[model samples]
Target: MDLSEIKGRIREKSNIVDVMAEYIRLQKVGKRYRAICPFHQDTKPSLYIDPEKEMFHCFGCGAGGDVFNFIMLIERLDFMGAMKLLAERAGITIGDIEHKKGD
Candidate 1:
């Protein structure tokens, strides 16, 4: 899938807290959520998840982005691969969109 389409899908299906929860034990912190960074070793919960922005940033390691970005970083894949993986998780058929886009 293309960048915008992937971004749109991520925006639709992902909640920042829920996505972050997959990798870390998140606790409510003020308006946002906090967790330890999974990408790097940490002890004091340096990961921050902004649900309203649909973004994550690590205060310790500087990794940041939306759900797809998290997937790309953790899975070590490029954008399209992350999109396909997330699309499958959401049960959205990428092939259908691909077919329509070609027309």
Candidate 2:
């Protein structure tokens, strides 16, 4: 397993709504979920989640991305750190991936 493989597993195993629910309260709206944007001071539900696309977008503050990006921003972690965190959440081991020459 490499970075791409890890990402794929994370996407496959993690649901956007489920992950977002851990950070904020979500209300189902039509086919998506709505929540107050975590990136800014939001009074109304401005963050929308599209589970089919596995993506989220904030209309009020313009914060948006996939689950990994959300985790990175919300957790204040870099790419690899977010990957490791999400891997653990998805029950995938980072040790399964072969380390690069210098890493």
Candidate 3:
């Protein structure tokens, strides 16, 4: 699959609330969940998780995205690397883990 296809798959499989909760101290806030941003030093809980959209946004530092984007940003990885990372987390295999996308 291509990068876009991989991103789509990751988005479909990712749960925004769950991924955010893993890295942040999250709390239920009205219809969404809030947490301090992990990408940068944050206070006042500027990170928000919208489970309905399967995405997160950080008002403090502008960090935002579906889980793939989150992983990419957090891990300093490219799109394929992020997909492979999440695929491992989800126990979805795509051939050799060390293989590049088109290799």
Q: For every model shown, what is its TM-score relative to the native structure?
A: 0.82, 0.90, 0.79
**Candidate 3 global lDDT:** 0.78
- The lowest-lDDT stretch of 10 consecutive residues in candidate 2 is 94-103
Deviation of model 2 at 78, angstroms: 0.7
Look at candidate 3 and give me any clashing residue pairs. Answer: none
lDDT of 1 by residue, 1-103 (tens): 5556755875598666776677678888889888888889898988888888888899999999988899899889997788787877777777634434533
Identify the leading candidate in terms of TM-score: 2
Please estimate how well model 1 matches the true structure, expressed as its whole-model Cα lDDT: 0.79
lDDT of 3 by residue, 2-38 (tens): 4555556666776767766676688998889888788
> Across residues 5-67, which tens digit of lDDT does each residue of candidate 2 receive?
677888888888898899999999899899988899999999999999999999998899999
Clashing residue pairs, backbone N/CA/C < 3 A, model 2: none
Give Cα distance to truth, residue 3, candidate 2, Å.
1.2
lDDT by candidate, in order shown: 0.79, 0.88, 0.78
The better candidate by lDDT, 2 or 3, is 2
Q: Which 10-residue span in candidate 3 carries the lowest summed lDDT?
A: 94-103
- The stretch of ten residues in a row with the least summed lDDT in candidate 1 is 94-103
lDDT of prediction 2:
0.88
Q: Candidate 2 vs candidate 3: which has greater TM-score?
A: 2
